[model samples]
Target: MDLPVTVGIDGSESSLAAADWAAREALLRDRPLRVLHALPLMPHLLPARAAGGRPGGDLLHEVEHVLAMRHPDLRMRTEEAHDAAGAALLAAGEDADLLVLGARGSDGFPELRVGSTALLLAARTGCPTVVLPVEPPGPHPRDLVVVGVDARRPAEAALDFAFAAAHRYGLPLRAVHAGSVPRADLGGEAALLAGALEPWKAARPEVEVVADAESGGPGRVLVEASAKARLLVVGRRPAGPAALLGPVVHAVLHHAACPVAVVPGA
Candidate 1:
């Protein structure tokens, strides 16, 4: 059985939020919190005295101490690998129920994040991902979790993951149909979105479901809604034949108030 969730911890406030959120989520699910910090073999990051003292990386040790102070109950582990951070995370995520990451890195996103670690995990990981933002969400949210759907089969998988997340946390689900442009007959689109999600909502009657449609573009609307939402879910465009990644995923990933999960195509 999968033990619990794993959070990628660094010396960042956004990463700290991920640790706290992962702790709460793991506790709620009655599972362990695996806090992992991977250090690449970069000797330049060490102090002058310790630079020549140790060949191995010690920055990751600092990460462990920081996370331990915040969450003592969480099981902390360290990995020293020369591989990329995303690959190390995937190795750790193999047995995890969920993987949590910060939206921005320690260096900061000066250019709206050209590439994102959260997006990478979503593209490759088997488990779902949760991305934390720097600030708190807006006062009132239209939905607990908003999922964006398109004219693709992976959209159905995305909806499944979104509903599953809402049900797991006893939150309401919002199905948002965001497309390139409005069709001439947009009346049936709402019904189509509802129809896609109705089966899952029916299976889990305790959770509420709402269908929302936007006539304009997807990226801006998603960013606006994400400002207040607790979580946002979108289908991952991972280099498939029909892989189509709009600007919405990048927008929401860069500025969302809460965590975002991207479900890859099955």
Candidate 2:
């Protein structure tokens, strides 16, 4: 059986948007879609009236109905868990081809765009995680799929994913490397970036690869590039139990104009 695309639903507009995006992605990949809801287990039982009129299960049914209406022929399933949202989604992602979540949860503060659960999963999940913002960026005709690379520690996983997405969407692939040096050093940085992408360019001859190196903070450069990108891909360093996301990944996740994909790398 093919691996399914999994998405976490919290009845928030952002999560609904994520579900919609996941549905489209599932269709593109020819895979099944799985919607998962995570609810906290209350220690004490309250009267029916004291509780909300509808149980948490109703959210799942509503989502299922919405998906059916939008994608009648798509194969989909729903699952509910009485566990922490992060833990449940992490477990579900173990057998999934891709995992998606909303940038913010229902209880999230307006100023804090990304919720804790999404951040934790992106940092720890084995599979790729795509975080969709509540208000998606414009769909520009010239939009490309962008990926950020650290030439010193290049990651093949992120480059491969970006190239595949570009090929699938018939778009160009833009590989960006940000340097802290002055503008004069950008040329050498661009060359290093090109060298890092040379192998992938050969492997995916159809994908038009553009290498760019700019002088500025890495996060700022990538976020600016995302203005005209359909999707942004970045790598997460795997440090075992001591793993922590770099500043660039954190900034991109919180501020990128389009959906962000975090791929684990060595």
Candidate 3:
């Protein structure tokens, strides 16, 4: 069976917007869409009692209806789990092609850019996880893909995701490295960036690839670049249980202007 594109919802506007984005992505990938809601069941309630009556339960049906009407040919399914949102999504993502979620959930403040669940899922999910901004898309968006590249680690997973997405969307891909590299090492950084992208460029000869290395903090540079990008791809090294999300990936998840995809390092 084909792995579905799974999206986690919590009945918040942010999650619903993610659902809409996921539907379009599913269409692009020709995969089924799975709408999942994890119900935080009450201690006294049975699993079935809180199955489809939670805040997000009704919204699941509504989301299915809207998506079905929008794309009648899209295959879809809805599921509810009596567990924590993060755990449920992590399990779902193991068998999923991609996981999409809102930056924030229903509980955060208006100014919050990302929620706890989104952060955890992005760092640990087996498949590449896309975390959307809490607010909707802007009026004018750039049709380009920006991916963060680290020369030392050379995240092959992130490069694969970025190139594949750019190919599917028929957009340009920009590989960027943001750090305080010594002036003398600029040439080496450039070469590393090119080396990191060489395989992807060959694999995706049709994708337009641009390599850039800037002098600054990774977070600051990537966030600024995201202002005009349709998507930003980053990588997490998954170092043990405590340090899964590195500083750069964490910063981008909370501040990226466009949708952010966090791919686990190989």
Q: Please provide, for model 1 over 1-266, each residue's C-alpha lDDT reduced to its tens digit, 9 standing for 90 to 100.
A: 84668887555677767777887777666677777765555666633433545433455566667657876766655555555567888887778888888776565575644236666675677667777766656577535777887633436667777877788877787777766555764667666766777677787788788777667677777777776577888876544443344567767777666678766555
After superposing candidate 1 on the true structure, give the runs of residues whose Cα lies further than 4 Å from its correct spot: 47-83, 108-116, 140-143, 151-154, 180-184, 237-246
Model 2, 22-96: lDDT tens digits are 988898888999999877777344223224654466787888899989998788999877788999998988899
Rank candidates, lDDT, best first. Answer: 2, 3, 1
For candidate 1, what is the TM-score?
A: 0.79
Alpha-carbon local distance difference test for all models: 0.68, 0.87, 0.86
lDDT accuracy of residue 139 in candidate 2: 65
What lDDT, from 0 to 1, does candidate 1 have?
Answer: 0.68
Worst 10 residues of 2 by lDDT: 43-52
Candidate ordering by TM-score (highest first): 2, 3, 1
